[model samples]
Target: MIEACQVNRSTFFQCLNGKRLPKESFFEHLLRTLQLSPGEESKLRKLYHIAQIGESVYQNRQCAKKCLETLAALSGNLIPQIYRLDGVAQLTANWASLEGDNRVFQELCHLVQAEMFLPEPKIDLFVPQEDSRFIEYLKVLYRNSGEKNVRLRQLVQFPQGRGKKTRESMEFFDSILFFLASDCMGYEAHYYYSEVDFADTVGVLYPYSVITSTGVLLMNEAMDRALFSAAPAILETCRTQFEDVLCKTKQFHTPFKGYQQTVDFTLENWEGTTMGYQYFATPCFSAYLTRELVDKYCPAGMEERFDHYFQSIMAGVFYVSFCSEAGLMDFARNGLMNEFPERLVPPLELEDRKTVLETMLYRPPENSRLYLMDPEKTTVSDEFVFSLAKGKRIMTYRKRLPKLRMFCFQEQNLMDAFEDFFESLPESSYVLPRSEVERVLRQAIRCCEEQMTFDLSNQIG
Candidate 1:
């Protein structure tokens, strides 16, 4: 490969092994030699650019930190900038005036074309309901592509309880049914009922380009005045936020037949198993909520309803989790303590009881398989816990948050990646049988009493 690219073997090896950055020309030549497809070439070019920046920043700690901050600002630009309207009209006019000269629009067009080639590419749209031209363009692209590798998630806002005709007029219902029936493309549509007044924004995200309202044009509102970006970080941020909204928002299912069933099935079997349960665990203000606290926190006139519905749901979940932990404690006392009684140390003087319990709860189990992924990082969330009770597999992906991407059976490669990710989590635990429940409880009570006695003795001394 080095000879073919007309580069020295040592230099090629250095670049290949990340010992050094190759010249831009050499890198392009290497890509050509590898016969990379257009999409792969684009990805490699972006990666190369990032690598160049990374190499420069690696030399200086302050510069690296500043670079990261700048990157974060760029990624989060979508959030703060979306609300700003100052000079939006002038900017839109200027952008629209560019017409054919707009490189970003051209790039979007190229991306729309490239998406046809991707196997199960995701396309997320948050567009105005009246924009027929853009919708038509998408339909044409999908029809002509003749490829089934597409998952489209669209978010549209509607007037509460009176948007049936509006939706039908826009062919929104028709499009959803068409895509759902399509053997190749998976479809999901969310309808946001605006309870409060807010500025309208339109966005469309594909694997390559993210297009959003730039506040640039006044004349044509049909995505003509929107800003487009191919920057990976920005696209990723947009995609992530879009998925967040989709998951939390209500779906437009009234006019669309079988819509609810489709969504329910998708979420239920999302991880490809009915038995597995995934929990994104974060620190709650308090694990156990008192009646007084619930009354204080919950709104008046809604306290009873909330307690009956939402509170009950959460209480059941907390109860199950508490019971699970208690069972583990029992197993520790009866099974673990019997085997390794010397390992248990009494709490030291002035040591907090809470601290001791936490330590005991987090201690690594013996006679079990252990696998650790990377250390917990990222402030987004605490942990992603996946438990397969039937399979006796429990894994916790610490310091990682779930991405806004959709996974289907057809996207086997992506599914495999998820499987590997779940398998890589550090923590695992097994379920104890119902027959052992009584014994587990008894052991747990004894352990608690022993700890109380030890702490009382230490205080007396």
Candidate 2:
């Protein structure tokens, strides 16, 4: 097989033995040599990437994968339980004995669980950095808290301010996507740009703490030693400290519950908002929506609100959107606006689709980009829509729910991470490039025209 691929056997063996990562050429050669099926080849490629990048990357990847999957099917039964983070008891015991490295984390988790039982429960967290597993776990805890209303106000410090880069910070930014992406009302974060210069900085005793109803767990810069106490004076002091710090921080994100809130926020922040990249299951229907069509088809009570929302998008801005090929084809076939309520708004006519496509093909809006991602190549669910504005906000909407819910995030690090994530998506023929977008739209227009002609002929007949 090595001779067939004309590769060195020693290098191949080394890669197999986990002593070295396989080169891209060797990996592709091996795939071809085995004549693996497309599915198997895709799996091998993912495995190869994981091997090349190390487990830290995969750890975050798995968190995203799990979060996306959970969010896609989010409903009555599939909702994550308001549960305890496993090993809290053990970790508490370890902490009591001063035995384990993760005792602080476990104790923190236990406090969160205890707070769930209290009326009007609140948690204040001062996080200096991101821990992937812990963040994912906290998301579950907060998300599942639901009606219990366990509000968590987290004050995060970005390492970027210090001009130092690390994998943990990157993962933290990645986790912030779902942290703000969901419908969870309890989770709120405020972030400040600062380096932890505790020696020079006065009055900040510990850099991290989890303040709960049960107790306040304070950890120093290293997180090795902690002071946990339930005394009212101590708790009040910590709470005051947190509030003082929070006053100096900017809000990370905000939630827009329904149509009015979403529209108001969008319109308020519309000016100078450059869309970094948007991922939707279907082509953005709102962008091309006409006022006439909006008036004609908008649901009885929602006409004014719907018109304002559509107008905001049509107002013009620099933006790029990523959509699915299947979704584009679906739009071409049915002209349905999947992002909005299906029952409320009627689908566009064939002529309308034609105009939209022609406008896209010939006089494509300046500073606007449209690309179609191969649905199979992308991990995003059809139910989810993620929109990012450069250094401004990240807005995500889920269509499956009854109402129009959107999470608008203004956190700088989150905006940065999402911008990086979107820009980093591999552009290929499948994930159509911006340059080739006109060609694809032209094809869709032709399809629309062909269908129109067929309908016309049938009507005449």
Candidate 3:
């Protein structure tokens, strides 16, 4: 093949042996000399390019590991309190007279604020990639969005390739905080995957944009030039383009209105064999709840439905649940569950709760595993519980009130982050090892049993 390709034998051998990368000409010549079919040639060319760029599965794995670590660290701090910009001074801008891109961007930020002040305000954004300049824009949108009746819809690239993920393209995790920060504040994202380079496909025409009913700001890729338009024709054209692009996309983030919708979504995507992970303040009660327990404790009309949901959640599945020590003690003492309303379901009896802990220790389901999370070692929140099922979805349930809510994240790239996050937790310093967890469970069981005896003695006295 080297002879047919008119390449030096030693150089060709070096390339084959991984000592040196194949040159573009040499790679193409070798493909021609081999008389390979179109598919074979394409695959080889891709492999050659990947080798030249030093992209490997190992690098992607390492990148993914780092991203997961960052995510775990940022988990507790993801939600930012909504800021009111009431007294903030608005920047005055003559759009046509704007000289620099930075000035235009500032003006655009002001425009976004103006839109937010309107009743029923909605902002449409097209972000081709994780451009640094737009971070400020996103910040503005999320900060005040908490209190205002504002809506944010974003169109973002999936940040991947046609085949395996590339290290350079794995920026989804970097922008995940933005997606999660505004989750409760009327935020939605639609995503699309391009067979070609994602940035190259959309970046040329619409690198970054913020569109509202009244105005539009289009920023160049360099972040140094922008076009601001309030003309009806220009605004309509941008709106049409956004809708056209949105039509080719799929919804990336989903918000569950209530328990029924959350349960329905879970059952519809159920995977029996997948090992799952949960991060909650206490053990996942759904996995441990028996039919009788559900019938006894579940709300009046929700018995059969809750029972079915609980059974479906646990059936033929393995799970590793991370619980806080304080939460376990509370469960052992008060029988309180984060998921169910105490008024409706009521706390379990001391003996019943003891039995549940004992079952977890001795006769636990074959698929169940528990780990204790050290509060001092991790930043995970008690208000949020994350349920991750492989190849299914990651459900985040917020137990705090005004109202309870669930957010479902099912995008593949985001799922990969959660999967890595979960897998890394078993080895994380925040989560206790199996032996430590077993010791704690025994302690909790003994505490429950002693509490039961004390109450019985008091009644006798």
Candidate 2, residue 423: lDDT: 64
What count of clashes does model 2 give? 0
Candidate 1 clash pair list: 91-216, 92-216, 92-217, 93-216, 120-149, 148-184
Per-residue lDDT tens digits for candidate 3, residues 60-131, read 545644543444544343544433433322233323434465565566667777787787787898754646
Model 1: per-residue Cα lDDT over 290-362, one tens digit each: 3554454444454554456333323332211212333245333433211101222221222232332333334
**Regions more than 4 Å wrong, model 1:** 1-109, 161-171, 195-222, 253-461
Score candidate 2 by lDDT.
0.64
Task: Evaluate residue 234 in candidate 2 and report its C-alpha lDDT on the 0 to 100 scale.
Answer: 76
Per-residue CA lDDT of model 2 for 1-461, tens digit only, reads 87866678898778778898778888878888999899998888878877776655455444433444444444233444444455635323312422344776676677776776687788888755635445666777666565665678887766554124333444454566554545556677777665556546777666678888767877765565566777778788989988998888877666677665654554455456646456665766656655666776677776666666665566655666677666677788888877554344667889987877777677666655677765454444566666676777767666554545667766554455556545655433336566556667777888999999999999999
Ranking by TM-score: 3, 2, 1
Query: Which one wins on TM-score?
Result: 3
How much does each candidate deviate from the true structure in C-alpha RMSD? 20.4, 7.5, 10.8
